[model samples]
Target: MQAEIEKLIVKFLNRTISNEEEALLEKWLANPVNEHVFHDYVQVHYAISMDCIDDLRLEQSKDRLILPEIEKVRSLDHNVKPKGFSIKPYLKYAAVLLVVGGGILLLLSKANEMENPVEVVSESEVIIAPGTDRAILTLEDGSQINLENDSIYEADGVKASRAMITYNATKGKISSEVQYNYLTIPRGGQFYVELADGTKVWLNSESQLKYPKNFILGETRKVELVYGEAYFDVSPSTEHQGSRFKVVNEDREIEVLGTKFNVKAYKDDINALTTLEEGLVRLDVDDEEFVIKPGQQVDVNKLTHEASVKYVDVASEVAWKDGVFSFKGKPLKEIMKTLSRWYDVNVVFEDKSLETVRFNGVIRKDKKLEDVLGIMKSRKINTYRIENKTIILN
Candidate 1:
């Protein structure tokens, strides 16, 4: 951090930067190195002033501040002055305006895409990098294979492509006995798998799926999501000669009526949610049964074993598979939990009551956690700190 830059940041924070100085600052930020440097200043300043970040209004103000001069000029009226102003309270003010956009780091990194783009450093400690496609596959023989997006692996009849693992069902991959393999996607990781049955499964972070390398014909085709979340697109049992397709997770099970759906049964969550996108799925609770209609979600309380179904936004429910984190009036607690898994961080709330704060936004999962946090800072959504792998939210 440069001394002159530090002083200028303070002046800017105070809403006192002159037009000439503002132009100079913008030029400095245009450089990737300078962007990371300014990012540090904001991080330091934000941590010191965390108490007063504005809610929704501050976010708009910050967005206004960060917009290109052309956009600013285009949107300005003859009577109004430039929108530069102080973000109040903690860095919450500075956080959203200077740092938070929550997507800044990711966007900056996206711009560079070099072998090693810079990161927003915090007190010399490195924050957790955003997760990529990575997981571990266990064969029936207990052999473990690490999966990465840059490489491919094959075993038996399954071929792991850079994007997904696909089984060559046309080979009729017959065996003397069923050999089950398991794919476990750890926290902060995701993967895709195409079953021998031609079904497609998008495994979410912290999820696992157990299925055989080959589905024997004349037998029921099935896979179990032992725990966590996954979006399934059935290949239609009709193609498999009317072979039954079943997805099981603990006490709940779904009999795929040749359809597509998402199952979220994370071990830590109290509700097992099954949201239908197409076709039909029969939900089985113990011996009880319910059929889910398109655009409807079935919420089964794991603790109470109670079940209920209602209509929901299908896009929001399935957004993760499409590279977005979409939410509608979701509580802070729930949102953080989802983020924690994707970013591989632990969230501790200083203000317990803040957990229920409702928010609705669609953010890209590839964005650095801080940038996403910046967007939340603007919402005046909550306050917090990142200490190593722990996010202490106030």
Candidate 2:
């Protein structure tokens, strides 16, 4: 069977065999041992054709092809053969030529396959735009907190500064009583928070945040975000204890241990994305699990059980945490959604023509909505008439 398989491989390599025979040869070589033999044959042939055997000798002055071993078999004629171990009929001159030529071609084919170039498509326009009025945090104690509101207040005895609440757990351990708090961000705003255990969170628009008043020092620090988008910069716990931060959206749970990452899980959106920035994270959906590494993004379909990982720019995923609106060539509809949130206004498009427009630029959140709209109108996509806190797009 081995000899027959080798002959078939030779025929295929020499282009003398039909596709059926090539398929048969491939099937036989699929076995691990057979594959190794095929690879060795190709490498030996390559060494001979490239004159690498001589180079090897010059470099090491020891390694050689030992062609005499093969030549002895070739020298034997049909009648002249050793008893019990003979190459009487198979060692013809034509057979020798076939073997050598097939081996060379096989090696060349392998080299060509390895050298094949990859095709890369040019950059395309952004399909989705960033959102505004992101999410809010509500406490289990029935206290609702608007992340975009500039009001100052206190939570769990900690004061709120610039719409962010700070808790100090340095003096002692965080009590794990789970004084649940919910976070919700409306359509035109975004907010962030620093948990007691040094975990930082950035919530997108129209989202909610549910967390404890304080993290129990020795227990796992968990936070539940009902719906929306958030980026996490989790600090590693002391003595390498490693903090565990979990984001729960519906039936999906994204688990991370001392990793910097972003989770965009909106209630209306069909997919949930968990993008890793500097550490590892696990995404659990419908009892299945997926592990993601740093610099990778895992996109999970909420409807379908399908999931995939892709490379992403970490800075782009968490840019909202820096108080800047960054768009990477997103469409007009997406841009309008984001604009609506920050300006606390509703956007209505008169004609569908504006939806096709795409823009790529960064705007400060501190900038007035009119200024941003003016820039968009300069591109022929105008916004006219502000009535009842809504902008009409023409």
Candidate 3:
């Protein structure tokens, strides 16, 4: 499967892939990490192809692609070239250059193609920075530790770095008592964690999760999404002696057999949303069970205890986990609610009718609050004002 996707990516860059093949490649790239993989491939393409290009075209392409002003990207010089460049040997590890300085060109290229790229606001103006890798780790003993950039914590068979915490695998060892730890992501914060059983989880801003420090062998691995949203990539049951995984909240529970899915159950939301990307999942809501397939979503109403399953674009549903906010005709109210949590600000809709105005686009989460609102203003969707930490929609 990976080989096929990589081949398709090569064809895509060579401008020879069919529409159907492009669709498949796009589906695979919908996940943000996969998108990073795609960029790495693009980096290799440039690295190899530039060696075969003429000096004049190479310099022109550099001028078009490089954007040094953006903090995330750096300028590329056309005159400089690696002394020894060979095709087969270099391609073997060309993709790994993304870690050093290869991906900046791809980032700038993406921004240039954006219909409404985030415009930089004035330096004198109030700047609300985007959320970062930050969270609160609550140990079983009721003690709490702040997790953020440049900070590290290691204890209780777990290790935490600047942005993520990982638990050591138990290796089939069973503990007599279960010890639970809580990870809470405050507003303007996000985090990632790997459980003892190898399941990876991404928590969004204003979310909390509770899970056992180590799962007992031959038992169902369980966790709770106390609030907000999370994306789960469960390790396959085959590797764990068929121990299934489960995620639960107050209103619903998702039974999984090693799948990748997303659940959004915010405190103020009217419904609990569960979207399955890969593998299968059984959702239990209000004592009713519904199995969902890939590209499907289940929305369980909190007020009426009703559940509905519908096919959806799995990419858009999980884009937040990839550092993007993707809206497909989503209403103003819904978009603002998401921004409110990530920006840690209050939102006021002065015009009641504006709440229902729909929008369609993708915005990177790394942009400042004003930069996001500016995109809406450019479209004549609406105007906004930031007073202190509150956003007023007019």
Q: What's the TM for model 2?
A: 0.59
Please, what are the lDDT tens digits per residue for candidate 2 over residues 45-130?
A: 32222222222112221112424534554454535434433112322322332233112111111222323211111112212233
lDDT of 1: 0.69
> Which ranges of candidate 3 are over 4 A from the true structure?
1-124, 378-382
**CA-only RMSD, every prediction:** 14.5, 22.2, 9.7
- Candidate 2, residue 47: how far the Cα is off, in Å: 51
lDDT of 1 at 195: 84
The candidate with the higher TM-score, 2 or 3, is 3
- Per-prediction count of colliding residue pairs? 13, 30, 0
lDDT of 1 by residue, 199-286 (tens): 8999999999999877888678878999999999898877777888899899777998588899999999999999988888898998
Give the range of the ten consecutive residues with the poorest summed lDDT in model 3.
Answer: 100-109
Indicate the worst ten consecutive residues by lDDT in candidate 2. 101-110
Best by TM-score: 3
Poorest 10 consecutive residues by lDDT, candidate 1: 105-114
Model 2 stretches astray by more than 4 angstroms: 1-140, 144-151, 154-157, 170-176, 238-240, 378-385
- Could you tell me how far off, in angstroms, the CA of residue 185 lies in candidate 2 after the best superposition? 3.1
Better of 2 and 3 by lDDT: 3
